[model samples]
Target: MDNLSNYFGQNINQKRIVVTGGTTGIGKAIAKLLVSLGGRVFVFGRDENDLNGALEVIKAKSFSGEILGISADITQKDDIDLIWNKVDNAFGGIDILVNNAALPARGIIEGNYEDWKYILETNVLGYIAFAKEAVNRMKVQKSGHIINIGSMSAEVKEKTGVIYVSTKTAIRGFSTALRKEINPLGIKVSHIEPGAVTSDMQEDSKEVQKEKIVSMEMLEAEDIAMSVLFCLSQPKRCDVVSMQIRPHLQII
Candidate 1:
């Protein structure tokens, strides 16, 4: 894809955006891409060090848009407030909200309860809190776009464990319901499912490569980031709704 042109050809610039877990992996890629396209990006993450490192990268890129890093744990209410308050005060309001933080579950039914709790809090509850807040903020402004980063595992239930599968499925439904309710308010909601991306979330395993079921290209974080930019570029009247992205090599 060609480089994204700025909002008004005034360098890469757009309205303010808030992205959770924007310090690393897919979230980081999305943040970088958005900044590249001239959008001010406010990133919230739990680790200050990681956030600073990410900040360095964005600075190195010399992104025309501003990038703010707020260290906040999404699971904690106080942290959430601090980040959102900063965002609200800085931008007045956000034009886009991307919920991309999540815990990866990779065990069988016999996995420990800790795994389940951690995943649920991060993947399900955290997303809900962020979504609720985003809705409230957007409602006041009378417009906004929300893009939730889901997973392909939501559709192929049998492939993943209980916690991961359940949260993804629930989020898909959440997006649909939220969209239905907010469409009248002109707040667009969308869920994007990405498959087989090379990121820290799947760093522990080479399972997909070992399987060797297909020879097509594996997805890159940039690909997912580009998809996000596409959704944002759409006219307010047209919502992309839901997008499921998978590597051509993988059938499941």
Candidate 2:
């Protein structure tokens, strides 16, 4: 008999996915990859211009699956609710939730409290809030996948900035506990940690250093996309809890 699962194909093709911060950087890259693989993706962000620009890029990539643009800050519950409501009404339930939204880097002791708060709220709260909502929906459907974008900084502490590292570390813990809580219920939670990818967030003064990493080699956004795809593409009977990506040049 034909069913909702059948439509999604063997590896979650028709599955509905929500990608936060899906306008640029890693998020945009992931959204594009997922759509190309036949999964429907709804991108959420705060800037209309950036969102529309990303929409154009994704469209130009020839994504036949549903591509939606939602202009809403992940920090706000109302905005999150609106996006989820649209997804629920349109796709009934989400099969994948990629919490890829994160605030730009900021200093630890030198940075303002506001900056720190923003990072925590968006990087941590935003991901958790969406996961909470997605879990509720998935609970009813009896299955779902939650993939959080983590940083290598989570494991390697650096003098560069502690705020970002702290929150990412929290995510590592969160993903583990969240998985244990929901695994029995059939939901899968995975964390993807990438080391030093070329992104807008890379420091300008350290461009040469980033270039070395990019050259001697850091993982491309698509590499991370593939890592994420691997976690999602696992057989329904299998579960991959966590995996980290490190370039050959990277020591830690």
Candidate 3:
């Protein structure tokens, strides 16, 4: 008669989650889906207008779950502090943290020092900082999940976007090591690496993205969101360490 014995495993209802970069693209898709499934979702992005708009859209379809959003830059420590303060006030405690905020990068030689610095702060430091905050609270609770959105470019190592590839590779290493360090505390860490997802980061237009999806050259943002759901829905005894998802025809 135990609900946890169900084949689908844990229920998402009422779980408090924090999703960074949730204003658009993959993060937004994830926020929407998690809210629909009855998880209280707190999302944040750098743009105020976009954050407000996304909150509206997410709230429109939300039935039982709650959705809140804020305008903050992940790269700034003060902003990150403010975000956690708001989260603590809103949800009391967090059950999940989705580190999805990141900037698209240019090749190593294509940008100036400032540009490179900005990307590194936003993409790498931001993730670690947020995870630290989540870990502090989760450690006390002794139960939580951290889901990092990585990219297949980590392995592909394509020459076009060296900086991005490097950041993703770091994420790959971070996720693995973190899981080893924290799993004994009853916390789960999962890394999801996706290939060629259609999002605001892509140069393709919506029409082009749809065409590419049909051709099996691109995947929808929602596809990655579903993978996250799969990881979260698993039994407490099981941990989904890492997952790599790609389009059927995507080659490197």
Q: lDDT: which candidate is best? A: 3
Clashing pairs in 1: 12-38, 13-38
Best by TM-score: 3
Q: Over the stretch 1-252, how does candidate 3's per-residue lDDT look in tens digits?
A: 456434333557889999999999999999998888788999999999999999999888746789998899998888999999999999998999999999999697899889988998988888899888999999999999999999999999999999998899999999999998988888999999999999988988999999999999999999999999989988898889999999999987
Order candidates by TM-score, high to low.
3, 2, 1
lDDT of each: 0.83, 0.84, 0.91
What does the lDDT read for residue 48 in candidate 3? 93
* C-alpha RMSD by candidate, in order: 3.3, 3.8, 2.0
Q: What are the TM-scores, per candidate, against the unseen true structure?
A: 0.89, 0.91, 0.96
Tell me the lDDT of candidate 2. Answer: 0.84
Residue-pair clashes per candidate = 2, 0, 0
Candidate 1 overall lDDT versus native: 0.83
